[model samples]
Target chain A: MTDARILTEALRDPATVAQLDAAGWTALLAIARAEQLIGTLAHRLAGLPMPSAAARVLEDARASAEQGRIAALWEAEMARRALAPTGMPVILLKGTAYAAAGLAAGTGRAIGDLDILVPRARLEEAEAVLLQAGWEWVKPDPYDDLYYRRWMHELPPLIHRERDRMIDVHHTILPLTARVTPDADALIADSVVLENGLRILAPHDMLCHAAAHLFADGDLAGGLRNLWDIHCLAGEHGIAGVEARAVHHGLEAAVGRALRLADRLYGGGLRYGQGRDRDMLYLRRLLARDDWGRPTRKLTRLGFYVRSHWLRMPPALLAQHLFTKWRKTAAQ
Target chain B: MRHATTLRIGPVGFRVGSDWRAPIAALNDLYRDYPQPDDGIPDFNVHLFAARPWRRVLRPSVHIGGDFVIPDAAPLPLVQGLLAAEMGMNLQMALGQRRYLLLHASAVERDGRALLMTGMSGAGKSTLAALLMAAGWRLMGDEFALLDPVTGLIHGFPRLISLKNEAIGVIERALPRARFGPRLEGTPKGTIRHLVPDARAISVMAEPAAPRLILFPSYGFAAAERAVLPSETFVRLTQASTNYVALAERGFGALTGLVRRVPARALDYPDTATVLEQVERMWSAG
Candidate 1:
């Protein structure tokens, strides 16, 4: 693997650590920590003889990651308690799902805001119930609220009034206007119920949802982590299961592309060709480094930013949305 | 901004990069006694970048960024870039630190036991801490008290005491010969100055101390002292902590353990001299 791709390789197999020096380990730790993959790094690199500075950082990362996992579970419990009375079967999503379900991906995973999915029909009821239970709209802007409600996948994110924790309540995975629209009801139907009565998207469906989130729904800003999710999920359920489910759910191309990307970047596989390899390398550069580390030049980030918007909405609506957002900023 | 430098304060390390050279020179001059990050690894990063192109060339304003960044943070003028770098480092630790439970407090140590003090702004914690250091108590830190959740010991941070407003003059008069950073006038905190911790504090920063006493000091009050109930102490400490909520259970355990084991008091005094006397009395009583 080239320098950009080595970090991912190291994450997958701890044995790759022997090739690194103090400087290399230092840089890798910074990059991993910044990407919120340090827990996974620390876990993978466990028992390896390394510099004390790197070891201390890994220790800190492991501690933080464990705290995040515990906090993620606690947040899930709180949401279950809050929404249980409304009788909405709260479907956990993404990192929170991985944590709540105790999947391999959950181990050493750093969690951010809690994300949950409910039936679009019951979204309003869930919102009201959550509001009564002390969650308030984070963005009070009328236009932003209109945009999210009408076009986007989630509610204008709600934050706990007291805890200052954020929750993203989604009715679907992608925006309504996106090119691919998976059957969200089918997803809800196939969810696996956890012991505590929380529903998580089934394993195969979980992979598809993660793929849709990375390649279909949002910008690949954090594609490394999301793709690592694919890597972990695929490793556990087998690529064949995820690929088969992808074909069943009209996401074969997205899932295949995600798998190929993750594989080509980390594994010694020929799933993807050279022309696309360069782009993935550029993306890997952006994702592997700390914020102050190496960057994916302004033009490349701008390209992805624009491409993300393009993939999100149709060209015409995209223009109007960007203009309105810019105008709002100007007015402010 | 072209020059980059690395400095380590106690356990944490920082690499500061800037687009303007003034902030770098200021950091170099002010942080002369601090150890260079020679292990070739820094735990945190601070970048002082021009918020705008024009801001870099004329009437420069710096935007703070690093591993843990807060976008849209207000920009600071070039003169205050040192403060921006310090603030950026502090912000990263507050948001991203995981090795220890972080409390917004100042502490001083004697006989291997630490005296931790916390209060709201203008409460004279910094002043009282500087005074304590002058009276032979080793300054642990002025900004953060790093608490080990496992060992229940307080690790020394020993950062420069950022004396603000009237406290600057008060500390200068109390320690007539102590070294001070350039007097920065008209800051948001009004005439800010950095007082370098004594040589012993810097050298012995790696030592850890068990917390002996906790005080909630209030400045400019009629002479009054009260015992802080454990419940009040716990709540106030939680509120005073930077990472208490983020660290979750680990934080709860560390804080509750401290409040239970350490004695606490609320001190209300009219001036630093009286507070110093009260603190000494409290220490003796403890």
Candidate 2:
């Protein structure tokens, strides 16, 4: 295993923290920050008599994470109130959902932007309602807006004109051009309403969505945090529940891969530490090393950047999109 | 990227890494009087690297990077690398710091009590705080006055006094023996220079001071003063603080406690002398 794997293991181990010096603490914090797990680290290491230097960093992380959580909740509330006019069932996804549902995954996660999945048919109605309620297009570029509207699973990103907050309203999890299209209807239909009048994806579907996010959509930028979310959800749903849910969504292989990677990275020295060595090596190579959690010089981010784009779209569209992007950048 | 140095100012320790030796050398010279952190571990890290590899040799701009970053911030030329480092450090603290309610103010101490003066930009708070320091008042800080959330005690962070424009010349003449950085001209913020804080301030940076006076100073005005009601002061302070909203309820309670106990006065002064006199009078009364 690499230093990141060691740091990942140590993240939950108090005994390991005791042995870490300044350099170790610095590396761990940077890795955790890059992975968006610093808050989780802060939460886990709360009781230990942490050194002032390390403790101060965690304090800062915890404060930032807390602020993000609060802002996310506030944005969700605003979105809920805005969507009420259309009477659309606005199901919160990812961080916002975890937070609204009081899930363990929400504890220290710093949600970047608000993500809410609405019914595909209601997408236009939801967009109009949000617009009238103050959300404006974040990407005002005509081509970009058109690209998102025509080819993407979600509308172009919206920013609350008054609050300056950005939110992504998705009709489905994966992009429309992606190879694997999960049944958005099932996920949306299974959403459970919370006491706060907000809706969240059901336990099994939540696990499936997290797996899909890691394997299908993202470039594994914050893969560790995403895995932690999966870990937390899996713990709540139990292994059988997660397996059944993934099987139902046709994401059993993706879920298994994520679980294996998690075991390799975070669950060593435990009963579930029997991840395949070959899988670990391949997954590690594919992940971007320039990310905060990665420090290995041999692994270049350029390799995975293209791969993520390829995974999100087909070859012809990807080639055309890349060309257009290159031309635009060159012109600028 | 190799020239690096670690130094501590008050409670905060910083590891400043630079691609060019110039910035690191300059920081070392300027901060020689200040002590390094007891432990080598830094509270914050600042990386001053060139934006592009070609930029490292051609035009050579210093781009700030670290644990906390504003991705779109413009790069600074090599000549102003030290300033870039300082700005980067300040940026990280302002954005990342959570243990304290950070106030965008200048501070000075007298008899274990701190005088925090905050106002709009060009308010002359920095200049007044420097003048007070010259008058034997211990300068607690200039850029940020950190108020501990639990105790409400002000931590001393007497970083290099960033005197700009005419304020640079003002301090240059005021203290002949004072150490000052090179007179940098024609940059982002007009002519700029830095003044090394007094050694006394450096030695006593660890000592926390109870805030005794809160002054909302307005420079270039008719010399007049008015008492700020606690309720009004709280609202104004919440605005003055950079991390008040981020810290949420703890910040609210800390600011609330400080405003209630500390007598706040809005001092509109034409010059620094009047402000100094008003501050001295307030301190004496306390």
Candidate 3:
């Protein structure tokens, strides 16, 4: 079995850690860390017997995860306060949403930025309010700024000067130029309000958002964590009305591929038809790490890098965007 | 990873792997006196790998990676592989160590009491700690002082003392018989040479000592001394710490307890001889 598969197996069944030797634990920890799932793995294998070294590393992981959770929630609160004057109900998305709602998918998850969905009408007002509240534009380059304003789902990312944490103010799930456009207004309308008055997507919408993020978004650099989220959300909410919701949003294909891959990796007994060769290639791209945690299959990674851009924009726009980015990097 | 080795330093253990054998060989020789980890397992893993297949042979740049990494860190040439390994291990500790309140300080223990000297790099803390070790004080650590939040004691992490540039000449002259690693020139930190602490330091490394004095020493300055207020010490220490914010409440408690219990002073001197005398006077007065 591949070293990446060892990580998947351990995540599926934490009890398998008991049978792993020193080298097994080493490779497993390295892979889990490389995939940014060490905290989730630490949560899964918390009570299991393991080597002292592994225990120490996981103990640190759990602590760091707790720190991330605190930081994530704090950033959300800060954003809520900043946008309070706008009188808009801020819909939390992805990791922050799962965390604020106390979902299983968020337990020990390493969250990076604060993502919120607001009405597209108030995008300008929200950006102005956040800028006044010490969030400056992260992208100073005018071309990239223009690109984000025109074609991206989120505003140019804003970073708090004092706290140094980034907040991605997203209007919708997918970019405007993407092939699949999830109904943003419907998403905001269907969001469930938490005790703190912040909102999160309902179960089915949440699943669809996770699926879209995994399949329709950027290169699958962090595919394992995204798939882990899918597995947890599907297990808790079940795949009952998710298909209908995804179909309504034109994301059924992405959602279907996500569920099939999650089940294959984590063994939930959810069966689907034979996955396409392209989907299998995605799986290979996700599992392209060696035993020592170095990324192998360079050509496959490059292919997916191109494919991610292709999925986001049309061929003409893709060529233009790639050339612009390549020129900028080369000039540097 | 083609060559690997593991060693325990005080409360922490490290398993270092490398694509080339020279770095591991250097580590094995320098850490010969250090004990292996308790169960043939290490608390952290450090890997030195090439960015690409051809880079491993041509130019042979070694990128420092492990459980944690600083992406975009410039690669080191293969001849400086030892420096890369050392940096990789230090990087893991700085980023991943949450078990202790890590202070970017150097520490030494004498008479069952630890003296911690913390400041910016080139502030002479490392050189002072090395000189003290030669003067019969136990060298706790030179890079980081691991403060146990629960026990409120300073644990020893007597890895190699990284002597930089001019400090190398001072230490070599002071401890004429001390074992030294290869003198690596043109590193990011100018020239650096590693000094293995005396056998006594390694033999008693696991012992933790109650911190008795804190000093902020500055080199290349006029001889002057001033008491540092706890409030200012708290802020400066926070800035000096890499993991203070991550440790959160436990870190606050430990640091507050430390400032309340221990008196701190900032010492500036024109030369090492003057600082040695000042330290001796302060040690007796305390």
List lDDT for all candidates, in order.
0.82, 0.81, 0.90
Docking class of 1: medium
TM-scores for the candidates = 0.93, 0.92, 0.96
What is residue A142's positional error in candidate 3, in angstroms?
Answer: 0.8
TM-scores for chain A, candidates in order? 0.92, 0.91, 0.97
- True-structure lDDT of candidate 1: 0.82
Residue-level lDDT of model 1, residues A145-253, one tens digit each, is 9999999989999999987889999998889989888878888999999999999998888988998988776657667788788788877777556656777777877
- For model 3, the superposed segments whose C-alpha errors exceed 4 Å read A271-274, A277-279
Which 10-residue span in candidate 2 chain B carries the lowest summed lDDT?
B36-45
lDDT score for residue B12 of model 1 = 86
Q: Which of the numbered candidates is closest to the native, going by highest DockQ?
A: 3
Per residue, candidate 2 scores C-alpha lDDT tens digits across A66-114 of 8889888999999999888677788999998888888888988889889
In order, the TM-score of chain B in each prediction is 0.97, 0.97, 0.99
Which candidate model has the greater lDDT, 1 or 3?
A: 3
Instruction: For candidate 3, write residues B163-245 as lDDT tens digits.
Output: 99999999999999999999999999999999999999999999999999999999999999999999989999999888898
Per residue, candidate 2 scores C-alpha lDDT tens digits across B1-286 of: 3688889888888888887999999999999988776456777778898766788889999998777889798888999998999998898787778888999999999889999999887888778878888899899988889999888899978899888898877777777789899887877888889888898898898899999998998988888888999999998888888889889888989998998899998988887667778778877876
